[model samples]
Target chain A: MAETIPLEQVLGTWVAALLTLAIFSFLYRDNPVYKIAEHMFVGVSAGYGVVITWREAVIPDLIQPLLDPAAVDLAGPNYVVLIPGALGMLMFSRFFPRYDWLSRWPIAFVMGYSSGLAIPAAIQMQLLPQLHATLQPVWPAGEVTWWMALSNLLLFVGVLCTLAYFYFSREHKGALGVASRIGIFFLMVAFGAGFGQAVMARVSLLIGRVRFLYDDWWMTLVAPWFGGG
Target chain B: MRLQIPLAITFLIGLFMAVQFFVPHEVFQYSFESLLAWVRIVGAFALVLGIGSLLRTHWDKIRRRRRDWPYSIVTIVSFLAMCVIGIGFGHEPGTVFYWVFENIQVPLDATMFSLLAFFIASAAFRTFRARSTEATLLLVAAVVVMLGRVPSALIVSFGDTAVGHYLHANMPDVSEWIMNFPTVAGKRGIIFGVALGAIATALRVILGIERSHLGGGGGGGQ
Candidate 1:
């Protein structure tokens, strides 16, 4: 007996294949089929986001605690959860013209909390660590290769020049102008490398999609006709 | 009263959150976790508002019979169907919702982004002109990095000779050197500037100097 594929699975493969091709059709030019696919993509993405948010955030954080506190390892009916629940409900005030201003409370709370949190985070995570990494000694206390010293010198100078380029408080004349020009060179190289990486990633994704269409979709369609499982 | 209260709330919450970073007390730590939970809950509501706005826009388009109005119906229907199936059946594997996500959403998302490969190449072809010295350097770097990234490019045989072996051994090293040194330097400079700017902006927001988030039309009262 030959193996058999389920009806739903076959249908799903066709649906996926068609959608993939529909998106690819944009390469020729925009058309109704592409428009339909684009619109469907937007709808599906938005719907997916809503469902995930509700299940992951709202249900576990807000609703579950209220309904069955024990389910979430709470010792008692956690009334504290109601604070966020009420704040969330307050967000609906935007729907009404009279109470719309009330929505600002929750918005303000979120914004204030995040902004406050970001201050120490930016300093601790980005500023201190990056500065420490950049300011390393070119020639350490031990034996070092000339190439290592040269590489360190280039990095230190490149960073200083880049910073000089960003310093717009003073006019770029003479020494500053030279540093700025060097800075621009470093920036351009970094940007080019980034662009190359991005192009590679996109190309890899394209290859994966093409492989799926060829290996999965096409094979499923033609395998039965070829007397293969 | 409306404006003042929110501003005060913002300042107090912002200060507390920022200050809690330095505090090692268990109470502060507990409060920090609780506040973060509140933020998540509130953020979910914000997403609801966004989705509501999206639906309203499509609904209006269909009602007005705007250009490509029929397409709006497709969006609305697909959105509702996904929501109904997802919320009703749950998103676990073997469910209808999972099937829709795997077949419909994943393919659409991947194919849509993969199309960018062609678009980016076309864009680069048009804009990557070597008009200036900096532009030439960028172009050269991009080409080198692109070729160097592929292992096969490193193995280019010049009649299967010694030169080919040297090139094969050194190409990846040169690429890695550029990325590790010059790239790191440039990125560190950028990060320093961004971090300073972020701290300043956060402070301004916490102090209520940045009242733009409170919305427009004379709510800028101190």
Candidate 2:
């Protein structure tokens, strides 16, 4: 079965092993092997990004509109694609120091549009939805379990106390201090849970690499050949 | 002239788009549809600009023959090689481009991120001491969650299957309850504050009060 494997796949697997080991070597110290691997990784990722952007975005959105015959019916020869196409071109003017100021025009436009777009959308999407979900009935208009009531009460009190911690306009010398203290307790619990979850995620990633080393590279390539298995 | 015009543009464009959200009319939407197309193209171009900057930095290092400049050559060569291969041939699965990405890039990235596990473990060991009440509480809560999340298979190996099952059920339930109640409550408070702050910042930028983004090069027309 190993002999029947394609040369490219075997080679790719070997290269992958080398790259993985190189990156993992950073655990010891930042050595030559790690630096080389890191730089290569950075370069390849950027290059891949460019290829993807061109293939997915540029050709399809900007070029195809003008080139495709059906685009006439869809957008009525909307040479509107050229508007951004030109702006995108202007972005490269950063390479030229004299005309670099021209780059700011596109930057301003992008920033302005983004700021405008995000402000309303953030409110509509995140702010309002989260608030609405928080404010829903504990009983939910149906069966009333103690568990449900208790959880709802916890959630409501938690939100209020948490908000009180952040409300800095009032001095925290009295009752506000008490609510804030409760808020700190709630926050610590949240942080602990979140941290635990994150640790698990990172451990899973380490397990994956170790699994690859053991199962994919060594077991497949080395162990069977040596008759160790 | 430059500062005023650009500021006006930011203000008007922001105001127009924000107003567009409220307006159900086709005219505003029609204009928006056009604006969005440009934004996508510009965003893609922004990525190219970033890549150019990265390449230029490495190219300069190589030119100057800085310490470990040989590594800069490796970066440039790898970048160009990948770029050429990707552009010359499509990046479909099983292609050389895809293979390079999956084998070389993916593994490297995953391994780098996985290194954080060791760092986190060491940090935890150092930080989990019970010097104070708050620290003790934090350490205890962290231990509980970690134990609660441990797989039942591991627990079964240590003890009885029945005990493992009991641990699995209660542990996950307790962990989830902590997340659902306290986490949501704390996170929601933070979210409201963050959202308000973001809104205020956005308003400042739109109104041209935040000219810091215009860059020290020419924001003041100096």
Candidate 3:
């Protein structure tokens, strides 16, 4: 019986459903319930992060193994791992103005590593791959039809003009200016498409929430059996 | 000196990471991997900063009893309550924290995400109006894609053929044409222009010629 379905289990799900509906209602208009739900989300997320840091990261990875190295019976302790962990811990000192400078070790480490990572990754992954992929046949000749050829030509033209549109040093005159303007139009279309996709993705998520509220909770509550039960 | 030192460090580390990707050195691989792991750990700390900012913003509003003060009160109360539940008994399966997270957090996030569907429909309606050649092209492609993706698209027809089938069947052909003829040529033109522009920009940045992102202005400095 103890292992069986509990009252809190039953109540929690329904309460959660109500909160879900409340937050979703904000799409129509902002209200206090939505505010409460939003705050709850933030609070829970922060608390979870802290808990995860303590349990998964700080405890086993940093504390337990380091504190009792001989007890674990490893070849030897990896003391080097402690350096960054200590630095990370010192970052909490920033909360207190007196010890704020201690935070710099960790902050500097983070900034150093991130800058190192981004520069190389950005160049190799984004810039290089894109640049390499760009150089291609000036015209479509293979299994391509007339429309396909035309579209490819348009793409080629669009890419050039778009590139031209961004060119700032040279004074755009006559043909250069006309091509640049055409390039701007293509870039705008691309941006618009990307924005549309983003909006669609977000809205689809919202719709799923609404469906759960209406079909799962509301409809279930008003079922014919509920009137007598 | 502070700025110069950090910039130098940045250049060195970035160069190391970049080289490690192509280089087959064991030490480089180990250091780079270790550096990546450290970055992920540091990223976790960023959430703490975010939480602190959220607290400060809400607390200030509450303390001042500013416009929409009641909302702040609700926010603060909810935040505190959820935090208490989460911290006190989150790991325990039957605890309030676990219950709230599974029941409340999961559902809410899911619901919020679902709202995007309605928003997309509204946005699409506004955007799909054809006023120009480009707009018409966009509308037609969008309609085809939408129809092609759905089972019901077969119901909507022109002549004997299902609009979706016709659209999908021709999509590859159309896209290939677009890609090969216009897109390829356009891309080439864009690349040439971009390459020249980038070369110029890089020269400026390296020589301290373009200093806009650096915030001060021109790169002409000591």
Candidate 4:
């Protein structure tokens, strides 16, 4: 007896392969096939976003707590959810000419809350930690290797020079000019490393698509004829 | 009244969010959590507004019979179909919605991003000219990091040879050092500036000085 491949698996592989090829068609030139795939992508993504948001945020956080018996019992029937829900609905006011300004209220609330929440977080998470790390003693009270000490010294100076480069208040001339020049070198290296990492990530994704096309799509189609699974 | 009320709401909400961080009281904690939940609910509603805008744009395009208008039909149909399937049938595993997402959306999304690999390579070829010292450093660093990140066996074919063995041992270490030290320094400097700028802008927003979010000349009057 021979094993059978499921119809759903076969159909899915075909669809995925075709879509992958459709996207890859752009590498040749912009064409209708690619445009169709792109439009489908946009539509599917938007629909998926709505579904996920409704399920994860609105239902569990807002609707269930408001209406569901089990959820109401757990959270004690909170009516505060109405405020944000109303604010959210108010966002649709942008569609109406007379009520367009009403949209600004929710915008203001979100912006204000986010901005306020960010201030202390920025100070605590980014500023203080970075400052402390940069300001560390190059020659600590322990037996430090020459390379370790050199690395620390370079880091401290590099950070200061980079900061100087960004300091547009003072004109870059004399010592400041030299420091900023060095800062540019460090920045370039950092950017290059970042670009390299990004390229590697994209390449990995490309490889994944290629593997899917070959292993899942091609193999599934041809393997049955070739007496392979 | 409209402008003043929104501005007042902004100030009060912003102040409360900021001040609540310092207050460890149970009431403040509870209120903070509730406020966060409200943010999430509001954000979900905002997503609906976005979808509505998308639908309107596509509908207009189709109605006008604009260039590529047929594609708009595809988008609108797919959007509605997915939404119906997802909402009506539920999006859990084994459902048609989940299958569509797994087969259609996932493949489309992955392939779209994977296409960037080719574009980025093309871009690098065009822009990575080593015309100056900084450019040379960038080119060198990029090449070194790219090569170093790959598996040692792949890059160093003659791993049994002395030079190849040395490279295999040290290439990753060198890449690690570059990322750990210079990258950290450069990124930290940038972060410091950004953090300070963000704090200043947030304070401005909280104080009603940054009224650009209000739209239309950012005037106080409606």
What TM-score, over all chains together, does every model reach?
Answer: 0.92, 0.90, 0.71, 0.93
Steric overlap count per candidate: 0, 0, 50, 0
Q: Candidate 3 lDDT, tens digit per residue, A1-229? A: 2224366855775887888878777887988788777767666666666666655555555555568666545456758666666656765766776555455445555555544455445555555665665555646456877655555556656766777777777888788899887875665455443444455466456666666666655555434345521
Candidate 1 C-alpha lDDT tens digits along B67-137 = 99999999999999988998888988899988989999999999998999999999999999999989987
Predicted candidate 2 versus true structure: per-residue lDDT over A1-229, tens digit per residue: 4677788888988999999999889889999999999999888888888888877777677877878737435645558788888878877777777666667667778888988988998899879988998898876767888897889988888888888999899987688999988888777777777788788888889999999999888988868788863
Candidate numbers, best lDDT first, in rank order:
4, 1, 2, 3
lDDT of 1 by residue, A1-229 (tens): 1137677787888899999999999999999999999999999999999888878888888888888888899977788989988888888887776777888889889989989999999999999999898889998778999998999999999999999999999999999999988999999988888887788788889999998888777776756568762
Model 4 misplaced stretches (Cα beyond 4 Å): A1-6, A72-76, A139-144, B151-165, B216-222
iRMS per model, in Å, is 1.8, 2.1, 6.2, 1.9
Query: What proportion of the real contacts between chains A and B does each prediction keep?
Result: 0.75, 0.67, 0.32, 0.75
Q: What is the lDDT, from 0 to 100, of the residue A4 in candidate 2?
A: 74
Query: Candidate 2: misplaced stretches above 4 Å?
Result: A66-78, A92-99, A139-141, B24-30, B151-169, B216-222
Residues B1-222 of candidate 4: C-alpha lDDT, one tens digit per residue: 878888998999999999999999999998998888889999998998789889999999999999999999899999999989988889999998999999999999999999999999999999999999999988877877876787475345775688777777788888888888888888888999999999999999999999888883232246
Mark the 10 consecutive residues where model 4 chain A has the least summed lDDT: A1-10
DockQ of all predictions against the true structure, Cα-based: 0.68, 0.62, 0.27, 0.68
Candidate that beats the other on lDDT, 3 or 4, i.e. the better one: 4
